[model samples]
Target: MRLTRFTDNALRCLMVLGLEPTECITVHAIAVRMNMSYEHLVKIVQRLAELGYVETVRGRHGGVRLARPAEEIRIGQLLRHTEENLTLVECFDPETNTCPIAPACALAGVLDEALTAFLDVLDRRTLADALEPRQQLVALLSRSLDPPTPSSTELAS
Candidate 1:
């Protein structure tokens, strides 16, 4: 049950935003801190804003902030917004599927059960639960974000 990069980035962005002490955090800071391309994150922020997950403020000193509290934002809810489909197999969506073996394939049933289990677990977890691990993540990310010093070999060049 691999999540798409889009979903992954969105989740990361949300987590970063959640980590901030202030009510809002600039997109530039978020991108720089995470070492992510600012251009791509723009789209993710726009989409989340449109979905009412994050609120955006314009002009200087303005940025994005969470639309709701971390505990209030359930992981499953955001996942549904970010993901296009949960189809683990062709028969998962009847509207677009015409597989000949879909009717009686044991594989479809097994996959269906697997997907359900995966979703059920995610559905049970909230962003608040995920935030508990932030202490370690934030420390690691903060160190990684520090500007690299030129090594002796690179400086010689």
Candidate 2:
């Protein structure tokens, strides 16, 4: 099953914060580095702040940092918060199920098992897991802090 872009971006935000546990990174910078929309990242950051994943400070120097340690931030839990829906098929959502064979569909059960396995694997991992080889991640994300330059394709356009 494919994850929504929102979930993917949320994970990226968490990774950025995880990379610099002590520093408050701006949503704008993350948007620039990840090539995402600032407005969308702001909303995601707000939701993450509300969920107690990231802490925000408001002002000229205001930005965000991880509210909890990276090791404590479970990937599955974060996905649950960021993903609006995890239903892989119509039969998965009780309120919206309209399939004729939902009542007896073996495929639905198999899909359910697959979903569980998927989340279970994620559950075993944490934000820290995503930021492997600490030094390398730090360097990579540090480079991301630089102002983005136009790509060759964009320059051509």
lDDT of 1 by residue, 1-157 (tens): 7898788888888888887735688888888877788998999999999998889998887999988887787788788899998888778888989899888889988888887787788888877687777889789779877889989999999
Whole-model Cα lDDT of every candidate shown, in order = 0.84, 0.89
Best by TM-score: 1
Span of ten consecutive residues with least summed lDDT in model 2: 138-147
lDDT of 2 by residue, 14-98 (tens): 8888888898878998887777899989988999999999999888887999999999999999999888888889988889898
Give me the runs in candidate 2 sitting further than 4 Å from their true place: 145-157
* Model 1 pairs in collision: none
TM-score for all models, in order of appearance: 0.88, 0.87
Q: Candidate 1 overall Cα lDDT vs. reference?
A: 0.84
